[model samples]
Target: MSTAHNAFPSQSATGAERGALRGALRGARAYWEMQKRCAIIAGSVNVLMLVVFHIAGLDALALFSVGSIAAYALAWLCLQRRHNRLAIGLMCAETVTHAGFGFLLAGPESGSHYYLLLFFPALFLGSSPRRAMLPAAAVLAAYVALDAWVYAFGPMALISPFDQALMRHFNSAIIIGMLSYLAIYYRKRVVSSERQLRAWAGSDPLTGLANRRHMDATIRALDADRRGGELAVLMADIDHFKSINDRFGHEGGDMVLRRVAEVIQGCVRDTDHVARWGGEEFLIILSATPLHQAAETAERIRRAVERIAFDELSCEGAPLRVTLTLGVAERAGQEALQATIRKADEYLYAGKHGGRNRVCRHADDPGRRALRQG
Candidate 1:
């Protein structure tokens, strides 16, 4: 195998890794925005709670509220400074502090334990699932230890039944609100993830064109709903592709492929389907297009590719030019789509052998027709 061929897989893997990293960074930024919003809302709520507790003459509750507000303010500052790790750390610390202090102030019966439940979802929302695992485990351990300690040591202060009932109701409301926010956030994340996965599955990783599998699926769907309209397929291959790779190296070969795909897409109608068939080959499915128009489109694509300025792609500063060979075939009514593809492939090779830079049509080639008749 050539060095380029041997290197292509590794290059593709590296590209995928880069793409994944980009996606992860995007997800992290989105999560940070959500966390920031949550923090601001929670901070505002804490301020209101502080005022209420102060008016009600509940000194202990007011003190806890002040601490919560300070923690949220620091978290916000860290987030604004783009210190996401620090922000996450502070948020976790604040959650643990709330759980520990709330338990010491009011104990289990006053719903102080509900504050501990927020830690897991908060950690999960602030960071990726993989990264959040350790923090979440630690939070769980702290929650358990604090609960055990609180139960063993007893409630730090005795309060009236009315105050205890009010605290329980307030804590319950907060927990329920946070849970609802998490549910909506989780649903949105799931939907966004599914869309990204579908796009990755259907598209060519390098050129961003439709992949062969997606093309096959498109052809099958079109065949099922022909509506008696003419459907044409143009199979195009890069001429002297191996030579291009040999001269330009794999990176340059990739650049040429991407440029060729752009040229092909530019030549076709928006309604038409274009796919990177495999390697240097591309397939265009033109629905409601006659055989003649498909050939014309193929010619346009060939001319566009020929016009690509390859000087910038060359390491040696020598100008380079590339050409395309295409085969045009029209689907006969009720005929299998694979048969049409096969005929197009046959014509494509015919052009490759006849002269490597031209479009071939089955109806225009008498020799191919005569051979079939024979």
Candidate 2:
């Protein structure tokens, strides 16, 4: 591996942090699955309870109304653990159910007021913050209205048992809001850690470019139609790069390489990608640009590197400069990824043989006019 200094931010975490993140990512998947199965079971139980309560009739409505919350809670718990897009079904159904339940125990003394406490956890388990807050707030607003219209004040104030329960219900909503905030923060951390691990798996330690393994994956992604742009590839090698290590030491050579990689990345578009292709060679992919355009782009990178002065780069020694030779090609006619790569490789070698530090598009083609440009 080259000892180049990369500009990419380092994401190495403490041992405990790394282990915790991996465990969380893996565990979350299983938890979601478990929650989903449990939800189905809970839904079944709730259906049974609702049926029994409905059959009994009369004031049974007040007693059985809480069952709606219970049933919906199960569904929310199940969805919170997975990628189910319809998780909001839980919120929608639950909210409407709560509103119906609210209107049912209309007495100034109805218990429907306290039932609102359940909304907090429901909100916590709800599919999204907005979904959670809306229902909870609506229920709170309903209570505010009920508080003014309840009968405990006897025809003057219509306060009922349900309306009286509003304070406790609102408290529960606050708790759910707190818990949801914490959960969201935890999720953000989990996602950030996973992103770091992904970067480590695919990036070069020295240059921050995609490692060869990642390049392979990128090629697959390109062919799978994952990327929308036309595919162009480049293979580049440093000109007489080894001599720097021979003259100043490997550390100095490393500094030079890091600088070159930066220059290359800077010259490329955000849509384009570059990877360390092992040793002193690099691979680049330019998106949305065709072959002839790719050649021009590659040359632009070449010229950018040609301008970097490495002699000032120092580590217990004078600085150094680096130059590169690049081979350019496109997937215009080739259907297979390997064929496209081979074509670029052929040109890469051609650039090497034609003279170091010049960009070459193809064999028999007039290449860079600069005198070895390095």
Best candidate (score: TM-score): 1
* 134 Cα displacement, candidate 1 (Å): 7.5
Deviation (Å) of 236 in candidate 2: 0.5
Error of 2 at 262 (Å): 1.1
Q: What digit string (tens of lDDT, one per residue) describes model 2 on residues 241-347?
A: 66676776656666776788898899898888898886677888888778889888888888898888766555357445567888888776436666777778777
Stretches of candidate 1 exceeding 4 Å from the true structure = 1-12, 23-34, 122-158, 314-318, 363-374
Please give the lDDT score for candidate 2: 0.63
Span of 10 residues, lowest total lDDT, candidate 2:
1-10
Backbone clashes in candidate 2 total: 22
Which portions of model 2 show Cα errors greater than 4 Å? 1-171, 226-230, 313-319, 365-374
As for candidate 1, its clashing pairs are none
- Which candidate leads the pack in lDDT? 1
